[model samples]
Target: MIEFKLPETRYALNSDVSVAYQVTGDGPIDLIVVPGFISHIEFQHELPGYTAFLRRLASFARVVTFDKRGQGMSDRMSGAPTLEERMDDVRAVMDTIGSERAALIGFSEGGCMSILFAATYPDRVSHLILTGCFSRSADRLSEEAWEARLEQILRLWGTGELTKSIAPSEAVDPAVIAQYAKWERLASSPGALRTLLRLNRQIDVTAILPTLQVPTLVLHSKADLQVPVALGRKLAAAIAGVRYIEYPIGDHAVWTSNNETVPGDIEEFVTGRRDHGLLEFERVLTTVLFTDIIDSTRNATAMGDERWVRLLGEHDQIAREMVSKHRGNLVKSTGDGVLATFDGPGRAVRCALAFGSAAKQIGLSVRAGLHTGEIEMRGSDVGGVAVHAAARVMSHCGSDEVLVSRVVTDLVAGAGLKFAERGSHELKGLPGKWDLFAASG
Candidate 1:
């Protein structure tokens, strides 16, 4: 038997609320491991799987793990809590240990919270590692599906086999599953779990996604039942600078079920040797275009399935041709909209106006918005507040209209592209108001 000594735990953060945490190991780099849902620092080492995982992590850096507020050894406060509060809990833990910055390793739903923290406080994070996570809860499951899962949790409470069912891969070992159940029971109260689930459902970090600037690694199993692999890909696609890796089918608990592969990938990503996931293009000047089909749903209904399919085929071809002609990259189609990037804002603006004109001739009207900024070009897409701002600008335009921000206007001032001031408008998910204008013939 390998004897593991428990580290001295402590608490910090003088704000009306404080958080509990523990630190262990004597490595050079500090690594903070945030729990997925329920965790207890005292009980974790007793379990072989959890113990091995932490020990392996500690091999490379000093490891810190903590019980989140309202769970484990932390103070259980009354009333429901928000994700921001949970992030603040993480901040409190770091402050308690006098750690100015550390690599964050977050698991399951904890991955989402980690992403939020990295984006909101990039400077404080040396590196970010997310496992079995998603960008937003809305993208995780359908409303009916989410409701059904919540009902199951309510009915099962502590004795329910919900954990085993949700994580079938971990069910192979009875001892491990039993240990997990025991930890879950001891880590959090039923009411706290319910509230956490509710907060998970309401959490949305899609708007702030592009703001993430630190080195990021996203790892997910193809067989994750709680959160699908598609959600992981979506998150990687939305963030400007991130690396994504997919493991063969396994449970959401990467440490236990897929321990063989998880640690190796994490080690490589952190050391900067293998950037095998998505490529991160940072601070490159580029033109961004946001286009959406006007009244697309109504048109689909009017044209019926057959004709609508034909029209969409034509629409795609036309857009692709125009993009290729201008040396632009057709990122990906967003079902009802298309996102493309260009080398110059002038050409991007021209492409947008021409696309709108071309669509109008085919009885299909399109609206587009253009902006130029230092964008992070990730594999197959662009990201940053500039992209979000461009999307918001598109939301304000009518069919066959092309809108541009003042920054883009300045970039293409001498390009002979005419413009009409649409005045300033407050954009959703963006800070402050923006001065927008419409392109004219």
Candidate 2:
């Protein structure tokens, strides 16, 4: 099941304008998703397919999504935002989140912005994924034809009339059309869309294509009606060492036609592995341990900085020793705590108990949570829903307490690891209620 929740939206200031943005997940890589034409941040999750698409992306990386100036929940502007201005908005969002580098995933018109951002700020971009994108708007339509199209859009705006143009495959479905209409209405007013579209047609990032210094992946549908597949091919050909893939489907919308196709392709390109085991990624049933010192801020205040630092150092060393003693891999330290992975749930349980004992000896109260589940191995890091579940399990813990999910209790049934039933709780951003137990032994 997908982790379902409306991510809390925050604002990133670009000059005086507030760019609405949201960040989700905690994977090693950071991804910034730039939306096409218009978007409503919260309204996006209302559609099941779109939510699933985002959840799939969030499964592998920390995703940062935002609304540009004069669009959805962001500050309204007087005129259409130029590529440079929109690029500033993306940078602002990244800066707000302290993201030094991120992979840019841009869809449709946003793809043009992504290209400009990647080309202009090569130092900040690690990888680029552009879907149904074009480098030169002039190649797609003549001036007269473009003007005529703009007029048509103005006339049919907000009435779900562009469903066929947007996603021809879903045009016949009334429910889909109705939902798209509502999304369009919430995305922007007719006047705003016209201005954005006019500006979008003026975008020509062809000159910067050769200057891109990062790996790029270009995806397009063969039967896309809005932008021809040839445009997508030309875009890929301009960039150095860019991988291009064209699907057989006809829809221009990224989340529709083949929902899994887009995310699956992206997953393979970015991580070198498809979701269904196409590449080198490994899946192992392992135990995850999350621990943190209780009331660390208060403790630090009472002990003072020098003494606190010394005690914290000792605490980390003890954690390392205990994890090693239990044959666990020290994934990383969380400043006030540590996250480790173990081969056996029983050993993991023993390690948590040892941590509590060790912390008490050092006059530190540490709480821990453990869960056994399959995890996606990403080089030295790990991800997937299990890690998120483990984190939520940790949040439910109290001072000097070691808690674990039911999976851990079941796995260590005969290992003599004692657990007191803690009942079930609904984990934040995760699906369903999970039964938890306190690791007493």
Best by lDDT: 2
Q: What stretches of model 1 exceed 4 Å from their correct place?
A: 273-441
Model 1, total clashes = 0
Compared with the true structure, what per-residue lDDT tens digits does model 2 show for residues 101-144? Answer: 99999888899999989988889999999999999888899999
- Tell me, what's the RMSD of every candidate? 23.0, 18.8
Give TM-scores for every candidate, taking all chains together and pairing residue i with residue i: 0.59, 0.62
List candidate 2 stretches off by more than 4 Å.
1-3, 276-441
Tens-digit lDDT track of model 1 for 171-269: 655544576677778887777788778877887888887888888898888888878899989988887778989888777866656654676577676
On a 0 to 100 scale, what is the lDDT of residue 414 in model 2? 78
lDDT of each: 0.78, 0.85
What is the lDDT, from 0 to 100, of the residue 223 in candidate 1?
A: 84
> Clashes in each model (backbone N, CA, C under 3 Å)?
0, 0
